[model samples]
Target: MTAPEDDAAGALAGTPEEQRAALERWRLVLGEPGQSVLAGGQLSEAGAGRDAALDWLYGRDEDLERRGVRQPRHGGDGPSVVTTVDWLDDITTLFPKETIERLQRDAVERYEIHDVVTDPAVLARIEPNPTLLKAVLRTKHLMNPDVLLLARRIVEAVVRQLVEKLATEVRHAFSGARSRTASRFKVARNFDIRRTLRANLGRYRPEERKVYVETAYFVSRTRRHLDQWQVILLVDQSGSMTGSVIHSAVTAACLWGLPGVKTHLVAFDTAVVDLTADVDDPVELLMKVQLGGGTDIAKAVAYGAGLIEQPRRTILVLISDLYEGGSEHRLVRLVRDIAEQGTKVLCLAALDEDADPAFDRDMGRRLADAGAAVGAMTPGQLAAFVAEQVGR
Candidate 1:
């Protein structure tokens, strides 16, 4: 009997090897039901390992049960039970780097399989990425000292990547635009190519089609901030705001010790804790953060307001979902009072890479009405806003 021509088979229906590989891929995608139709009731040994690794993570999804797809059953001569470490091993060994990373992300983020990070064996094997870093933050309390030590490597690696990425944005925002006037200093980075070309245009030789420069124009770099300004970052440490907490720590670290800005990093749940001392070390700051509790945004905001050296020059960034566990009326009134006094109040719903925030819209609108800017922003965008405010 001729094999049925499904989309997978039809698209790659060439040699027998290509057809088999495509069908195996489709089998993996379709789960257990695709076995008989796509792979003819069997998969190669590597294919079986890959299938088991995927099933280990995706099989726990309750939606599959609701969709009438039964979870893949093991044992009774099938593959053995896939422990977290074993699954990690199988995926890292059987899949490519990209596929392995995706599987690892699903295991921790979508499945909430804490063992992926909590287990030292798995932590040692898994690649360090943002998703894994978040998982570590959420579950770090569950780890022993040894596992926590291993988890710190993931934190450091991921935080270093974030700092490198954000530091560039911070530098650009704070680095003043090139001045039009020429400078005596001859720094290579401050070289004004456009101004130099314009200035040396008189010496251009038509025969050689090259400009013979008698003088090189170098523009002096100006500092954006002239007066001292305080940046009070009141970050909510509720369970839902872990991503925000991570970004806030990194943002504070990037903003620390600028020419004219003093950064205060305060984390709040029911109570507020000042984390400014640790702001220079984001890896340490993030390690010290407690990521789950009832949110008291008003209390945090009040604490931040107290830290303002100059009300007119301060930028109070309240990073939370606005699900206030404290008095909502007090929060709105406080924000309005601060904004009215010339303080820049920014209520960030999210401060992560995606910036896709799920926050209380009504409360956000209420804060906006109170003169506080309510929106979601990534770390880079927040730096730019702060830079603009400081420059002004």
Candidate 2:
């Protein structure tokens, strides 16, 4: 057989169904690991699903060292990739001061940036690794399978900045409410329930029948309560806003941990699910979030508005593609009503990492009508927004 026929025969050697499985296995194992690898060499039938299959491969990884396999020149089973700050040397030049500072706060703790900063030997080796960036950007492929994953690492970086800043802000918020819990739980040494009950009973005759319920007989409240924060984050979780889910969820985790905040987080594509109750690991929380839902701004906003237990102290944030599947006017009307109640309402059309301003005009208009101030934001900018909203 000719080369093509030989290849075809090899592919079809097994039953037609098994052949298809073999073809998939070949693509998974023999797939192009990087653009540099694919474009530089090897032209074969196996290359047909290279990009799509590799996208799936990276999704299986739980961390960076795994997704883009690397080995340390120092000789260990560990990947070779450089993760130290000395390796990061001037990566800060790529971001704003605030972004850099935020990243440094988180990176410095788990990794030794302080040590790397002083080590000239380590710093000398620091250089831009396109391969690392490529892996970061291309992670979006796991969802939609349509989004170009290029430069996505930028988004992830910004998302981390937002989370770090929000963590600081929330810590401050919790601090500001400091000592209140201790004061609230302090024992009232002057407990005279019987005396108080007798005093109440005396005011009404036996026939008047003033029923005095004793507090000692009352059911105790559970300790499940946390300090109350009335916060609402309106995220446009559409296909266009794909990567922003990580940002919003991380922000949610910080806010969720606040000592006294009743926090509610809702991410929307076409529809929205109230993810307030689940903010444990941002990764796991997001894995539960699937894309491709149609945007229903009105429904989502209304649903969020309903989540506010205290209108006066509540903060409502709306993030979206603005390509809403409902009436903008009605949505804005709802926003206006929520705002009128003293709820702090904010709306953003697109939350991209180094993204442009894109939004649904009618829905934007409705958001404005609702008295919501809308804008385009990145995860870094979102930190300032969160800080301002929480007044931390």
Scored by TM-score, the top model is 1
The alpha-carbon lDDT assigned to residue 38 of candidate 1 equals 62
What is candidate 1's local distance difference test score?
Answer: 0.88
Model 2 per-residue lDDT tens digits across residues 26-53:
5445444432322233434534433332
Model 2 scores a C-alpha lDDT of 0.55
Angstrom error at residue 37, model 2: 25
lDDT values for all models = 0.88, 0.55
lDDT of 1 by residue, 148-192 (tens): 999999999999999999999999988874556678999997898
Tally clashes: model 2.
Answer: 26
As a TM-score, model 2 comes out at 0.46
Q: After aligning candidate 1 to the native by TM-score, how far in Å is the CA of 31 from where it should be? A: 0.8
Clashes of each: 0, 26
Q: Which candidate should be chosen as best, given lDDT against the real structure? A: 1
lDDT for residue 335 in candidate 2, whole number 0-100: 85
Deviation in Å, model 1, residue 249 alpha carbon? 0.5
* Poorest lDDT segment (10 consecutive residues) of candidate 1: 1-10
